[model samples]
Target chain A: MNYQSTELQHQLAARFVVGSMRGLARRRFQRLMMDIPKLRDEVAFWEEHLHELTDTIPIQQPSERVWQRIQSRLGWVQSKTETTSKWPWFFGAFASLLLIVNLVMLIPADPVIAPSIERVAVIQSSEARTLWLIEQREQRLEVAAVGAIERLPNEDYQLWMLPVDGTPPISLGLLPQQGDVILDLGTRIDLAQVAALAVSREPLGGSPEPVPTGPVLYTTDLIRM
Target chain B: MTTPQTLERDLQQIALGDTAAFRRVYEATSAKLYSVSLTIVRRTDWAEEALQDTFIKVWHRAGDYTVAKGSVMSWLISMVRYRSIDLLRNRANQELSTDDFDEIPATDTLDSSLDSLADSKQLRVCMDELQPTTRQAIQLAFVYGLSHQEVSDHLREALGSVKSWIRRGLESLKRCLQR
Candidate 1:
């Protein structure tokens, strides 16, 4: 198969743009495009020609925070932490004191944390099959999957906390498919203020972003125990 | 909907690192780009990530755009679609896969409007001429990013049959588009 063949170029470009070319072949095609400008032209031609297919897909508006994230990432906006505080240490100490008080009242619980648990969540399927059981134990979470989670071999399930503040969800680590597992609920959130807990299917090792980067599989309310 | 000319101007301003121009561009095109990303990725989280990455690229690689690239919408759509596809590949990577790959990636409905929006346009005219199954295979391939084998499984046809449909369908589309 000659890489320079015009017909092959056309077929590959069309398939690449139409999205049939993928995996190792897709990577190889991309590498070939660097050496062959004509391949790029073919891809661009296919892109332009087949682009009208997108007009058929309806518009789904992005959340406003995407713009905010872009602005922050581009250094167009000052990070909230970068703001000058008149009483930085005082506020920090006050926050630490509040955290200490909360921790003192609620000791960190282990797997048998039923009595000390403050909140709990159950991730289930539409069939009412319990997929995961979560217990909020002070600053840590105890997550247990009732049974095996039949997931893609390369995929994982991540727990996310939907904030009641209407901000973006905060990742709470990957969920286990079997047995009991404890998760750290980081100091950034208060259990009582959380709106809900969600499980999203992510690539293995979980999402790299500050938020989930996969389809939200199930959402359940955090129940106070 | 900002005019194409305005979009070009926004891209130029973005190249100059102007945030206001970037916002204007985001306001105008983010929805459409997000929609395309979601339609392909089928997840708001990943779609949002793709949209964010696309805009980040738009901000830094604004100089990449050219009038020859077609409209700004086309460029944006192409950019986000590729990003969304990358997410799919990262998760599935089933391009040449033949194993029982039953994962239908997208959840969005893909009922197209070509029949109503069909004009004398070359692409539309040619698309209408395709066999129903061939057109459907192509649509499933493009919209859901399904591979030949996956499309075969989706449409319940033989793998060889689906491959032939796509090969011939693309040929017809190329001949029509080129003309």
Candidate 2:
């Protein structure tokens, strides 16, 4: 187990780099490399040697929504505070003031704010299981799942907005586990003479197949709002 | 217009809890990470989830990054690779049949600029020196993230043969690059 023999160590390092080395020997080698400067250098050498293999991959940009979601989840948009003073008290008082002002502003606003009913449709499977809900309002279409269905391991359900004109269904992105996921329907889709909403099971990430192999779990007619 | 050194410096700032640096890191590497994730997971949603999870992990563990481990970009790629591997491992359980190991259509071409990087250039030269079968075996293992059994099954070669090919191919690569 001498960590210093350049020849033997280099061979072990090469095997480790290619992922051919496994079991306790690989784990021990990784741990040993973490400590011995010479072993670390050898491992890095392999990493450098094999690094270009990654270049064979083409760069792809993910949807912009990814950034938005990351920002929202990380609370990155929240205001930053730097004052060392008893700022909690000051913020609490300021929040209370804003609340009072909002209450005052709402005193005679409206007794019954209309629940803005829009044309909507809920697509269900042959078993009458609701899979997705589509709503048209404010010149936009919103699509979401009906309930929290347990996601199958390595499978995803995608919502497609199909138009009556017999064109291909536009992907609205992956369905959420909960909450109403809103989508903007541009001029590309016609609201009138709209066909039924459909759901399809795709690979883990979603449909790479232009045509889905999984059955259409649900379809529902769109009712006018 | 930032140089790689400058990018690494910015990433170091991110490691120190700088939100601006975090945004910069996301801007710089999210797409590349997403491509790697999507290739492994083969689904958009799961790839998105992997991307989210990887970045979150990066945020929490940025402090753990050491210059000694590798370059900032390599370290980041390793994080994506590890997360994708975990996803792949879990997914592999459901679709583990030998029939599903057929050849996947090649979708994207390799970037030549990355080929010009000093380290990548060295790797390219060494990889080019290996036998075709051995090269494919190593690429399937590292790039496609296939297990040894998967490689053996896909190549229709014995499991021992696949192992030896990878070991020998990497050894040759190491020696060629060292020269």
Candidate 3:
């Protein structure tokens, strides 16, 4: 019960650094480590201690195709920007300025998209800032976020779709730290059975297991959109 | 041909935005990095994806590395590990199946061979001091990047107990290595 006990803290810190820390405890430990410089030191110590484990694995070369895929993905991201730039004439400076001005004016006068579904939810962090927007439209569910959140250099946040049926929550994807992200529910699960949207702090990318390793940071009812 | 040290110097130069150094750094580390990717991912396609991402990350985040952290190899390995883990975790979630969990190679064979080369006696000595359970827990978690739950399941031990073992094991190893 006494997590602060010297012996217990050392034990937990060591396990965490070596990667044996798991579940809610590991998540808590990670947050604690981030906040406490001493704890981070303990982690780095373990990392150095266990560095030799890497030697046990044979150095197998990844196939050339792996390199090709990375290049292509990077290329794709670059090309997307290029393609968007090509539309500048249609969405050129004057038109863009007008659209921005209109959006700014609409912010106060017009309500953001009203929920059409029976119930809609907006999940926000403890700081009361919007983190996710969940809405049901045309009997299909949708999740959206306005921007990627900035996170500590060493951490990541993951999105989850929880269902009211008490079944396991499905991972949506890694949350963007900046810029809006939209996910389509795509007639997969019954919209009525959906419960709430949840977010968990995870290793970069997301949790490896079906169950989340971190605590649920936010949860809110889905408003009808 | 550049030596590892020379390659590392070039990487440091690349970190300073020297394009020539970037090309050299890529040439030097790509094979080893690709090998690391293949071993963890087990899929050539995914490994390639990881390799590409790792380098791009290196290009962008090169300045983040500090010598105090460890060797260039260590820093780069950490990046690759994190990236590889991300890719593996994403793919695992998409598949919705646990059949293809990454496996750490058996240590006895790998260690014995490395012992023959014996480049770093300190590592071998430190490893020898660990209890089998502690050693196994650390190996599974660090080398394979298995979550604590996975390591517990793999070892068929209580999750709490596994955590303690790994933690204590790492502490003990650190003490030994530091000497």
Best by lDDT: 1
Ranking by DockQ: 3, 1, 2
Q: Which candidate, 1 or 2, has the higher TM-score?
A: 1
Which ranges of candidate 2 are over 4 A from the true structure? A1-39, A77-225, B94-99, B102-120
Give the residue spans of candidate 1 off by over 4 A: A78-225, B92-112
Per-residue accuracy of model 3 over B57-128 as CA lDDT, tens digit each = 665556766655556776666666655665565455342224544344444543454454355667777776
- Going through the candidates in order, their DockQ values are 0.25, 0.19, 0.28
Quote model 1's iRMS: 8.8
Pick out the ten consecutive residues of candidate 1 chain A with the lowest summed lDDT.
A83-92
DockQ of 2: 0.19
lDDT digits (tens) for residues B1-179 of candidate 1: 68999999999998898878888998898998998888777778788778887887687678779977777888898888977887776644445343433334322233345654458667788888888788888878886667777788777799999989998999998898877
Report the C-alpha lDDT of model 2 over B1-179, residue by residue, as the tens digit.
55567667877787688888888888888898898777667778777767876776576567777777678777777667656765565444443455455433221222233344455466766766877668777877777677788778767789899888987877677668668
**Candidate 1 versus the native: TM-score?**
0.60
Consecutive 10-residue window with the lowest summed lDDT within model 2 chain A: A82-91
Model 3 agreement with the true structure over A27-137: per-residue lDDT tens digits: 566556655666766655555545545655566655554444333333322221121111111111222233334434643564332112333456677888765554444
Candidate 2, position A50, lDDT: 66
On the 0 to 100 scale, the lDDT of residue A122 in model 2 is 63
What's the CA error at residue A223 for candidate 3, in Å? 20
What's the TM-score of every candidate structure?
0.60, 0.55, 0.57
State the lDDT of candidate 2 residue by residue for A166-217, as single tens digits: 8777665565443233454555666675676677887755688665557667
Native contacts, share recovered per candidate: 0.61, 0.43, 0.41
